[model samples]
Target: MDRINYQHLYYFWMVAKQGSVTAACEILHLAQPTVSGQLAVFEQAVGAKLLRREGRKLVLTDTGRAVFHYAEEIFALGREMAHMLKGRTTERGVRLNIGVSDAMPKLIAYRLMAPVLKMSEPAQIHCVEDKTERLLTEIGLHSIDMMLSDVPATPAAGTRIFNHFLGESVVAVFAAPTLAARYRDDFPRCLNGAPFLLPTTNTALRRSLDQWFDSQQISPVIQAEVEDSALLKTFGAAGAGLFFSPYAVSSEIQRQYGTQMMGLAEGVFERFYAITAQRRLKHPLVAAILENAQQGLFDLLDKPAAAD
Candidate 1:
């Protein structure tokens, strides 16, 4: 394999991030000439001009953009490698890249990270908030160490580390207070053509929700459909239309926007699970995160039910 200087790649990454040789120099605290020279060498080694001058501004060329994409991955993996090498054998600290589904923004996944931060060692954490399918894809690609999201049987190539209910909560079919009052306890009482916030297809949450709705034989007036669970919550909070989500997941948004969680003819609750590579589960850092999540869920379940 051709030898590439890691520092050269680092300099190139800085240039791409900062967008100018002078800006890169300021951030890297190196001479402008030195930064430029290193970038030149890096581009030469990669056989591409990574940046171009565009009327007093530095712009990444097409080749530059492509190179930077791979460069970012290389550097990210390099950082993780350094952390692994420096981490104590007894596992005093570690850097963890965790992927979490944004569906339940204020639930166990968000709160579970607390214990990791409280650890004695200098642990670095990177949390990526994404949907279930994307998060699972990241885990499969090894971009993340583990993920927390709604689980059913299996997801990607990960093992089921924790199989427990987040809470016995109901999925509320609600709208903004104004709209709910329009139905006046008779809401969802009939599929009277009120718009519903339907989840995008193919998601575990969506499949479960659709199943429940189908069983009830109700074809809701889906005013809008969204792919992102977080976006769905936002739309619901804004009173765009009535949507279904576990109350616990949207509790934070509801509290902020004063949205009401209304009763449905029947309740739909989602089951969440945490998944990780079987080998990764042995890592001390992975273990720590799982432990924190398990405890957090237990605590959440023990709390008294919130009034709808």
Candidate 2:
């Protein structure tokens, strides 16, 4: 379309933030019709319906959510500019926006980012968790500074994207104390016909686990296929079934979920990667994560018998 009308966008942003035209009108000191009219104009200019009325409450459409995301950043910068002009010091630190793939275990994600938090300079971290493909789209949009995933970005994902291999950890099975007591004896053989909580087939971990099971000739009864790693662990913790996770966080898993390690998944491993648009790492926080992960995190967790 033609040049965007910032005034119209501002009006739409206010209405979205306030949740209704009436509420926005109060804040804008404008009549409801004026705000609504501007929103309509904004929608037309953008060639997309930004909002929809749902039972007297306004809701953002998909396009609206995207637009609102940008609007929030724009207005935030504007506010910061105002503060600077008023001779006010802003405490805001470097803003790091990271998109984490859902398949990446929550503990792994946290450990990768923990170093950034320990930096002397303050940092504002915003993490969005979604599927790997969606996070790749976010990287294309430049919405996220970097992405953490269990898989690398393929060549088809465009040359602008670069996958930085963080490291991999051997996969290990875990279960509640009782379930562990049952299957922990025979090890892989005991897993046969045992109730198992597994990640969905779409994950790299599940694919590797399936191969490992086939190679071992083990057939565990499927209990549930969960998409979220945290939820999968929760199910395992509740004695729903034995589940697999990166051996890196096995100790943390036991501490957090009161679970016991059943056994290692042998050759099966869960790999981690940091996908970024920049070929050369420049973001200090991103650099810090890459440095710390390569130097210590993965190396320390690489010991095969650590969990035992």
Candidate 3:
């Protein structure tokens, strides 16, 4: 369409937010037919069916969901502009939308965002965790302000996204107390033939681990393969097998899961990056995160014993 009809877009946005045309009509102070007719016209202009009826309720199609995300940001800015015109300041503080890759360790993600919570000006922080590809799509759509991931966005990703290297952490193996005792001797060599729980092959960390194992000439018995980092650690905590995580979070992992550090995978490292649409960081909160991380968040620590 050459020009978007804001009235039609507003009507569709209301219907979507209210979950039904009838409900939107009540708030819009218009007849159901008018609202419904405009919705049909809006869908035609967009060249896609935005919503469908499931039983008696409206459901958003994939395209509809994407559109809704954009509508939310647009309307929010509109409201903010109206408030400014009225000489009223927005009561809610700055909003920072963050997308976290599923492969990112939970502890590390928390550490990266913890500073935002302590900001002098109260801020509203929202985080969504998903695969890197989906998050990158959200970035392109301007749905999220920034993304935190284990791997950086590459040129081949086909998105105008910039990756800011946050830092890297050494990988360390950990196991339940009993399990750690079993493989505590001989360090790397002791891990040979040891029961191991590993991340799925899709993650960067897993690929690095595979290479590290090959370089060390150590073959760990594959006990299980897990996709979620937290769940993998849970299995290790239950004494199922040993697991590897960034050494940056080793202490918290040991404390939270009742696991002990087995040994550091010396050459293996997990790198992190902050991805954004712009090359120069503008969001103050996002800038703070990058600054905090680079200063000391992933600093290397003195190696601790395999079994404490």
User: Clashes in each model (backbone N, CA, C under 3 Å)?
Assistant: 0, 0, 0
Better of 1 and 2 by lDDT: 2
In order, what is each prediction's RMSD in angstroms?
A: 6.8, 3.2, 3.7
Error of 1 at 63 (Å): 17
| Candidate 3 per-residue lDDT over residues 80-160, each given as its tens digit | 899999999885678898999988988888988998999899788889998999999888766789999999998976557
What's the lDDT for all of these models?
0.68, 0.89, 0.87
TM-score of 1: 0.63
Q: How accurate is candidate 3 locally (lDDT)?
A: 0.87
**True-vs-predicted CA distance for residue 15, candidate 1, Å:** 7.0
lDDT of 2 by residue, 10-92 (tens): 99999999899999999999988888888898899899999999999999887887788788788888998999999998866
Query: Compared with the true structure, what per-residue lDDT tens digits does model 1 show for residues 148-223?
Result: 7666425334554333333345566656788667765655555456678887775656777777777877677787
